[model samples]
Target: MSIFSGLQPPEAFAEAALALGPAPLVACHNDADGLSAGAILVKTLQRLGTEPSTRIVGKGENAYSDAFLDELRGRAMTGLVVTDLGVSSRLPDLGLPTVLIDHHVPTGVPTHACVVSGIEDDPIPTSSLLAYRCAKAIGVETGDLLWLAAIGLIGDMADEDGFPEMEEARALGITALRKAVSLVNAPRRTASGDASAALGLLLKADGAKAVLSGAHAETAALLQAKEEVKAALDAARKIGPKVSAEVALIPFSSPCQIHPLVAQAWRTRIRDRIVIAANFGYREGWVHFAARTGEDRDLIAFLAEHRPPGAGEEYGNGHRLASGGALRLADWNHFVHAIGFGPELEAAA
Candidate 1:
């Protein structure tokens, strides 16, 4: 049976939740897909007359932890619904019914939970789309909010042609959808409120049109952050490009907090090479690495197979074509050498 077979459609999921009596504690990732997924589930639960508690965890390493379990134990929620996350973390026993809705490749599906992910037979879909399926199944009026799923699809850079639902979302117009995606992602690392604020705006406003019209002012941080990213991109560009036989590296330090946008910008400019943007996180005493490769190469697999022995101190994760993580300063030379690249860094010693 498909792992997703155990997960019910939206209406059935809602019915099962209703049967459970107590509301769920919804944990979402702090990204466009995750934020939108959480909002969709939370709003649907509210519509079902259950007020669910919610929490946000950082991208990869911080998604599941002892503190997270303790937070859940302290809550009144009787169930757990994790969206756009949990695939990377070992799902621990919370002694409650747990459902994980995620899109990333799972390390291993925990036997203790019902997992909705892109694994084996299941085609990868954004978590927001999965949440919308549930909301639609529940007979909730979702016509207005359907565009929210499209925003996440674009944010994740997923191809929209295959899914008719995504096609319908794309029909809303490209300008609006792209703007909405930028609004969500631009502030994700530098500021906290932009993505949430955009989600709220999309959910409450009159669909995509309203979101497109007002996203600029509401996410003004996006504009400022873009400028900062542009400067970082310039610095990365000036570093020219260093190459090994297998890959290219563009290492630089930014005065502003390193957002995914800056890395993405650098990736677009240097598409000819397998680009690794290593942002120096001076304050944290580590270097955060964002790697982008072509369709033929698997960034995650490469990172796994060539990971530095000293990577024990690093933290982060990402998808196949693109991924990001952090490593301690001490691991710099080992990390470069591990990837079959000669080290060109000043010795930390």
Candidate 2:
């Protein structure tokens, strides 16, 4: 049976909804996967006869900050749904009925009433898929949301071989969705600039149709941006592999619109190798890394084990063999060295 099959909206989820009995508030991560997951949850809740206000808390590592939690608390939310985030730390203090749907390995399960994450049993299913299942358990169906779900899977790097069901689902009709997500996710001239644009679209988009249309339009822009970034990455790849040393630092920048694509391209080229890529943004910074091929190099485990003291698990993902993180420029060297890439790069430097 599919891993997703076992996922049922826990009784606590419905009870929590019933307890709220009216408009609830939702907080979700602010990326393609998180936004997609949030959309699914929101639509599902609406279908179940509840209208909820939704907010994007930000992206990656900052998604689950104490400030975000305080903001939600200030809203007097009766019930809270957190998607694509691991809020184990804040759960104890949240003091409200909550449901958490996430895909990353848990730092610890929330003591809250309902916590559903892929890490519990199935490592293969994406959080979107899990959220879809949870939605179904609560009598909320979103067949139209499949495309967003697929995007979340890809964005979360949950495309491993075991997820044949997800692959098959993606094959059904996800080209447009992928393009849409790619567009919003494409790198930009500035980190905050494109992110701001993407967040605006997410906030304004009404339903699946709107999301699909808006994403498609944005994707066209993304493709154009991708072309430019791809050219830069291609050049970097050509020069990058020849740097016969322990660490190969590929520092290059493109319009922020194509950053994700550039990161994806780098992942492909540096398979099983330790590589770091950074894009300088006008107001913010973006960094990505991959450990493609190596001997017993479990990049995901490495990051999970050594993530910075205060950094949340929201910004990182990988299996034992591969892992990646989004970091601010200030902590760039710290993370780079944490992954043991610094010593390796000393020779190259």
Candidate 3:
């Protein structure tokens, strides 16, 4: 009757875990997907009589940077598990036994270790699903984590296609999480700094009821923030239709705090098959880019190839059409040019 009852882990993953001794190091994404994956890993390790040191990193942050590599060296970590992130070519350089369990489009598979992902060839899977399989491989059979895993799936927009099994597992629980996600995703103005507070509430909430009740304060705050998001969206719309033929650009100078919501608003107005909305962030030197693909195109693939150096895919749970990234303010013009938009479009927006 457990959600994971019929699930089986890969043979290679079991072999790798067996080869490595106790006390593994887990590097996971900071978002819902990564958090759920990390939680599953923790439970699995505990069941296996092993301990794991957990570290959370933002998706947009450089996972392979020298600082991260140096941290790994300092830990003297022998076994590494990366979840909910795309595999980079630099992964092998860390000089540790590694296992990759992710759901992103891979740049390339690692030659030095076991890699598991959900690329085009494989049936679509979430990082939490991969983590659950890994847990099963190690003989851990807890089903309590399904709700958490479902949160990642919904947060990443994976629910669009509708995973019947996951949906059945989530049942009424997902409704509360969706409300929580919406409240947390509200826009920001000034430096009220409610975004982090919202995320904290979602992360710590005990259950569906707790999550909903905990978000009340944030929801109130979001009611006020919604105005700013609307204003930015309105501004973007004023600029979009005129610039459609010349260049597709949605520009707003507002210090919008909720990047995703603002982008979604702009996208709603765009009738084009492909629309990209650019917005000014709280920081003066940066801009956020949200690209929404028409039904005809795959925005996930497009954003993956076009993302800036520091950018990472938002995953939109599974709404491949909705994706976002950030770019330096200085590179804004160059990015627009690279995307094939012209100066006239810039002028119009």
**Model 1 misplaced stretches (Cα beyond 4 Å):** 1-16, 19-22, 59-61, 121-123, 191-195, 215-217, 221-235, 255-273, 310-317, 346-349
Instruction: State which candidate, 1 or 3, has the greater TM-score.
Output: 1
TM-score-based ranking: 1, 3, 2
**How many pairs of residues collide in model 3?**
8
| Model 3 error, position 318 (Å) | 10
Per-residue accuracy of model 1 over 1-349 as CA lDDT, tens digit each: 5543444334446555564345777788767788778878888777777778777665223556566667677778778888887463367687888877777666555777766664442456788887888788778777766777777777777745376678887677878778767666654454232345545554565655665565446545455655655565555556655777666776677544453445566677666666777767423566777787754677777888777666741333557777767777777667778766665752253
Candidate No. with top lDDT: 1
What TM-scores do the predictions have?
0.82, 0.71, 0.72
* Top of the candidates by TM-score: 1
Candidate 3's displacement at residue 190, Å, is: 12
| Candidate 3 clash pair list | 156-316, 156-317, 156-318, 157-316, 157-317, 157-318, 158-317, 158-318
Model 3 C-alpha lDDT per residue in residues 1-349, reported as the tens digit of each score: 4221212235457777755458788777655566667767766766777777777665235465666777778885668888876665567455667887877655545676577665542347678767766766666675665665666666666766566547665665667767654544453232343344444444455544565573446545555655666665565455543254423456655565445545565566655655666656445566665666545667766655554454433222234666656666545555566566666434222
Residue-wise lDDT of candidate 2 within 295-331, one digit each (tens)?
A: 4666565566657654544445645544455655545
lDDT of 2 at 311: 53
| Prediction 1 global C-alpha lDDT | 0.65
